[model samples]
Target: MTIERAVPAFAGFMILLSVALTHWVSPYFVWLTVFVGANLFQFAFTKFCPAALVFKVTELKSAGQS
Candidate 1:
């Protein structure tokens, strides 16, 4: 998927994973959901996402070469 799609997809996946972890693993996993939400919140104003950056650096290198 494109960066536009992948970022949100990744964020959603993290949120779900965090919730599952919180349920079966530990409450500390809720912090992960909080972190992802906060990053999305800041990205709204800053337009800078670390996940997107990582995706760019790693994903582009591998996928774009195809």
Candidate 2:
């Protein structure tokens, strides 16, 4: 998938996975959800996402970059 799609898919998957881990694994997993949320919040202002960077390096095109 393109970076534009993968980014949000990754975020959503992480959020769900963290929640599941928190419920079935450990309470500490909640921190992962918080971290993901924080990163998403930061990206709104910074316009930078580490996942996006990784996706770029892997040659996943952005929405319009194709």
Candidate 3:
């Protein structure tokens, strides 16, 4: 998948994983979900996604690219 798609997909995966961890492991894992949500919120305006940068290194295209 392209970087644009991969970033949100990874974020969603992280959120679900964090929720599961919180439920089955420790409540502290909920902080992970909070963090992910915060990042997404900030990214909406900043457009500075670290995951996107990582995906870029892997040469993934953005939306409508390639």
Each model's total of backbone clashes: 0, 0, 0
lDDT per residue for candidate 2 within 3-62, as digits (tens), equals 979999999999999999999999999999999999999999998999899888999887
Best by TM-score: 2
Each prediction's RMSD over C-alphas, in Å, is: 3.4, 0.9, 1.1
Candidate 3 TM-score, true structure as reference: 0.91
lDDT of 3 by residue, 1-66 (tens): 888789999999999999999999999999999999999999999989988889999999888776
lDDT of 1 by residue, 1-66 (tens): 677778999999999999999999999999999999999999999999999898897664433554
Per-candidate local distance difference test: 0.89, 0.94, 0.93
Query: After TM-score superposition, what is the CA distance of residue 60 in candidate 2 from its true location, in Å?
Result: 0.5
- Candidate 3 wrongly placed segments (more than 4 Å): none
How accurate locally is residue 60 in candidate 1, as Cα lDDT from 0 to 100?
49
TM-score of each: 0.86, 0.92, 0.91
Model 1 accuracy (lDDT, Cα) = 0.89
- What order do candidates take by TM-score, descending? 2, 3, 1
Clashes of 3: 0
TM-score of predicted model 2?
0.92
Question: In what order do the candidates fall by lDDT, top score first?
Answer: 2, 3, 1
